[model samples]
Target: MSAMTMLAVGDIVGAEAAAWLAQRLPILRDQYEIDWVMVNAENCSVTGSSPIDGFGMTTEVVDMLLTAGVDAITGGNHSWDGPDVDKVLAYPQVVRPINVSEARGQGLVTLDGAGRTLTVINMLSPTAALPGMRAPQPKPLWPSWTELAASTSLPGAIVVDLHGESPWEKASFATALDGRVSAVLGTHTHDASLRGHILPAGTGYIADLGMTGRLGFSGGGFDPAYFAAQLRGDNPHKLPAYRLATGRMTLGALLLRLDASGHTKAITRVS
Candidate 1:
């Protein structure tokens, strides 16, 4: 049996970043012999002031990713911020947070590639304390994971994207599921961690995959001026226009190689 490879990208910021990714992802795939590509697109649309208003994605951005050879797209807390939330939810290749109440999108998705099937699960950790952000904290996620495992017979390799702000939660969750899944990747923190390694059970893990967007900003796509204002106790509702960072931009992704039996063989990070 042959090995299967997959590349999972970090959070995508805006149209500019999306376009950059679309143009280059195919190249990266072929170069790395990747069988599938997954991306986090919760911030693909306009960024709003409030959590609800700021986290939606647009259909155009999703299409761009699909057209660029992305096999699946995962979303997080901001998954519902776009204009056509219903449409995004209906997409089979897109998965939203499994713990979000009344969320319209699937929490898990499966794709066939390299003569094997790969199951991808998207999850968000319980909300953490952000200095000026007000977001909902969901219930404990282990119950949801248990329920999912009981209900579904996960086939082939399993990849998980834990979008969260707390390092402790992400690390703990990944460690707990080390032997069960192929890879447990952390997203949403925007900065990549150097903690990529394979667990004792052959599962791959990372604290965060980092972000893909403009280089010199807080979260990659926000205007620094507006962000500073917010940090200064200004109203979030008075957010300034979206601004892509000047100078250079960067793309970050994690590549995983799995054996025929669905055990991780190697984990590589691409930036």
Candidate 2:
């Protein structure tokens, strides 16, 4: 049987990070022998001052990622922020959370590559909403992964992106679907977790893949001063100006290798 490799990138923040990924991702894919690439781009266009769900993720940014060899782009709570979100989601390669009742984008997508068929599902946790955000976030409906697996006729592989706030919640979700899916990876924390392992039934799991943005800021994307003011309650209503961090930024991703039957063979973190 043949083996297929995939790379899942963490949240991408601001224009700088997007450009960084575009330049380096192809090389990384080649280096790692990756056949597919998935990126979390919820914060791709966020500037500190803009509304959380009203900015970020422009068409140019999406195009850049697509052109950079990313096979699929996954989003979380902030997926609806950009003006072009509806149009972007219309693309076959992009996906939003399936649990969102009112969101316009497709929650699940299927791709064929590397001699296998793969289904990728994107979902956001009910706890993903941050306090003080203007937009009202939706709560997950807690769908059954086993049922979802049974309903889908695709026989190759299944991978999920569980974007959420609490580690326990993400872990629990992964455990519940351990044997049913090929992998369940956590996102939204913007920091890589030490936990990365294959379950007893051959499913791959990771707590969080971290952020693929500038390193020296709150959440790895916002300016530190902005968060400082918010913490001090000095400027609660005023949005701070968004600035990409200065100096080097990190590219965070996880590489998974699956057998022809869609069972995980190996998982590695590449930063």
Candidate 3:
């Protein structure tokens, strides 16, 4: 079997870290011989003000990643928050929505690498931080996956990015797709889960991929005092803050090697 390295990343926030990835990704590809790269840019384009209006992915970031040889990009609840998201989703190589609908861009993308077609699917957990989404149920989504898979026209391999909250929910999804997909990777919780391994059916699974940001402060590098103050209902003046440090970001990614039938032969997590 041919080895196709697919690097999956967690949520990315801020410009500095984006620049770093842009600079570092190509080197990693050259060294590891990575064939495909997928990143979650939901929070990267958000301004954190509202769920719909975020400023995460600037043109610079996109250009950088494109130059760095990223095969496809995926996003979550924060996709609509940014001003440029609609346009960004227009790229034929980008995977935007979690479901297959008349909604702008696509959810399933095909990457021809290492002489095989790899199907990359992006799905949002119904209970995640979606600002405005319909009812959370599997009935409507099951058909979406069925239709998307039908449209691929290739059955070499399939990888699913199950973006959502709740570990049990993510695990349930993985179990459901046990023998179907090559891998199921979770995102959006910022906190990485300890659960990751190959299922009995050959699917590689992980509860959460964690996030890409400062490693100093807890809560995925966000200001803990600010979060605590908000919880305590206190509007404290001059809240303590940590200076954003370059290269302090931690990245979580899943590297998978799949068989010709899309079964995950091996799966590994890289921090």
Give the candidate number with the greatest TM-score: 1
Per-candidate TM vs. native? 0.91, 0.90, 0.84
TM-score of 1: 0.91
Model 3's TM-score against the true structure: 0.84
Number of backbone collisions per candidate:
3, 3, 10
Q: Is candidate 2 or candidate 3 better by TM-score?
A: 2
Ranking by lDDT: 1, 2, 3
Residue-level lDDT for 135 in candidate 2: 31
Which candidate would rank higher by lDDT, 1 or 2?
1
Candidate 3, residues 1-271, lDDT tens digits: the string is 3556678887776666666677778877777667788887666643544233443465556667677777777776655555566677777767765563436777768887558678778887667744344212322446667776676563557888887788887787788889888888888787877657889998889888877766656746454555566558775555444233234778766677777666777777776
What does candidate 1's lDDT look like per residue over 1-271, in tens digits?
Answer: 3579999899887778889999998789889988989999887776565444676678888898999999999988777665788898899999988776755668889887557789899887875323333334555779989888999877778999998888778878978998888888889888888758888888888888887888775655556776677579877677665465665788878889999877788888887
Clashes of 1: 3
Give all candidates' CA lDDT scores: 0.80, 0.79, 0.69
Candidate closest to the true structure, highest lDDT:
1
lDDT over C-alpha atoms for residue 82 of model 3: 54
Instruction: Between candidates 1 and 3, name the one with more favorable lDDT.
Output: 1
Steric clash pairs (candidate 3): 44-56, 45-55, 45-56, 45-57, 46-54, 46-56, 47-54, 47-55, 52-81, 54-81
